[model samples]
Target: MKKRVGLILLLFSVFLVPANPNPVVAQDGKDREYYETRGDIVWEVPTDKKVIALTFDDGPDPTYTPQIAELLKQYHARATFFVVGSRVNSFPEVARLLANEQHELANHTYTHPDMRRISPGKLAQEVAKTQETIYEVTGAKPQLFRPPGGYYSESIVNIAKRAGALVIMWSWHQDTRDWSDPGVKKIVNKVLKNARNGDIVLFHDYGGNRKQTVQALKEILPELQSRGYQFVTVSELMNHYGTKKVGQGN
Candidate 1:
């Protein structure tokens, strides 16, 4: 009776769980080359000039987003915005303005689900939906895709590539952690102290209570400018530095 009940519960759980899209490939003796060259991951580039990509994630918020954009404008810098598709629908005008201001509008996701492990079908849907939304609302489809919370697998990268996006990650040392509302000085230091010529510094525009991010930016923009850093969108920076492939090393 005990064994029978265990079997019954196992079967019930099987019915509820979905299969992983990229099942474990046997590493013993097959398809080793494809395994070696699978996913696209761009964290930073290698350029000699003082140019970097400043990227904002989880945005299109009515409040903080516009303020950040204004700050960027004051510095005459252009940055990329990784926006949630649903928020774009909620505030299409804000998105339109980002595009009009010449900021790159990239895909964060439709609902910002953790993309670390997801089925191929669901991942494809999330990528396609956000691509469509950005194109539909702003008249330009996004080419850069960053996984929610930086949680992405090799399969997730390939899936995003299939949807016509280059997976974007930030520089190893430039993550501000401003989403946690770390003190304004800390956010300022994270970027200013770690600024580099091919660094991709991460910030957020739409997460809760980003006044610290906003405040940090006011200081960051001016200080970085004074230090001779030219800010450009992810795509533009990539173009400037020949980022035709992802994951260029310093």
Candidate 2:
């Protein structure tokens, strides 16, 4: 009886020991060398210049997306747009414009549901559907994905990964409340005050009113440009740092 009790406790102890926390695991050891050489799929930019990746979410909105794209073109800069599937359908022309203007078209889900609150099937649908629409419009599959309202879960990230996207989260951003018309100057100053190199800046395109948001970008981009910051797509910024590409697994 004593021996059995000791064995049971030892088994429990073994189970209690925590496993390593690695996001990606290579099934074959030989694959690691290749993946290591290829590098990470996505990464935060690590630089000293006042460089930042401007990313717009929930877009292809007829009202704001075209205007924003034109502003980016005028400044000779690039940005990432995480577009919604439904919006893409409603405004296919706008979708084409984003592609034509050389903006990064990324995934923002089909219906723009709060990604953290949905079932895995629903989440996967949201991600995969948007990816399909983006590819359909641009002939370029999205490499980056951002959740609606920046709310996400591990399941969301995993599903997005399976859809062949790297989860993109901004490193520096404050709630612009642009939907509320928080005044153009306030939004511009907010971005400028917290700006940094290798930082991902978040703004909205659809969802709600974005007039102030558009106005803000007009002000902020030139100021940042004058300061010598070159805006690029999210992938460009990540590659400028270092990206570790591992085998694909959900």
Candidate 3:
């Protein structure tokens, strides 16, 4: 009878083991390892419709945000802004403006910390705090999260996933290096050479003077228009072209 009881207890413990304990899940039918590592960085757009997402990171600066917003309005284009939480407090109106204009306000962390180096608790706090700040300022919880410097690990994805954010990375980088004030011509050349359909382009709204980057976007938008490209926000692009996973956008 003791041996029988031991067998039952062992079976019970097996039932207690958690299912899907792995921190990452690749929902699009791709191998989880492929999607988890380099794949999450989004090196390319992976489609052919001239649909591209223009995403700006590290933003809501008083000096640059308004200017970029006005330029986007000029082209009747939509973009996503991955904003820092502390900056939201510094320039709340920019958050309101992005919402009013229908651009996405995504989480980029509270102080732009290197997310990979931080503890999971701090990472959760960063994501949670920013989500709250975004909703407080914009009245909507952002569904996406972009790490500072495009850094992510399995643990980062796990923390963000637990916080109910989809990890968003970019494809088709324009690489303006706008932080260094690279000339508009260089920025334009990067996009002109690389711009493609279903691509997500990365730019910055804050971190330094972004005048050349702004000028480059003005040029790139019209030029791409002539080439027959349509601008969409990141979520729209994913929905329209990217492989949809169940439970996504739920």
Q: Which tens-of-lDDT digit does each residue in 60-112 have in candidate 1?
A: 99999999999999999999999999999899999999999999999888998
lDDT of 2 at 158: 68
> What lDDT is obtained when candidate 2 is compared to the true structure?
0.74
Clashes of each: 0, 6, 1
Winning model by lDDT: 1
Better of 1 and 2 by lDDT: 1
- My TM-score estimates for the predictions, one after another, are 0.82, 0.78, 0.81
Clash pairs detected, candidate 3: 51-198
Candidate 3 residue spans exceeding 4 A from truth: 1-33, 36-45, 245-250
- Residues 1-250 of candidate 2 have per-residue lDDT tens digits of 9999999999999999754212232323332233323332232566775667888888889988888988998999999888888888889999999889888888888898854367889888878888888888779888777776655445555687788887766653544556657789888988888777787777888778888888898899899998889998887776664343322432
Ranking by lDDT: 1, 3, 2
**lDDT string, candidate 3, 1-250, tens digits:** 9999999999999998744312232333444446534434343446767787888989899988888999889888889999999999788998999889999888899999864367778888989999999999999888788887655566766677777787777662555556767688888898889887777778899988888888888899898888888888887777777665312742
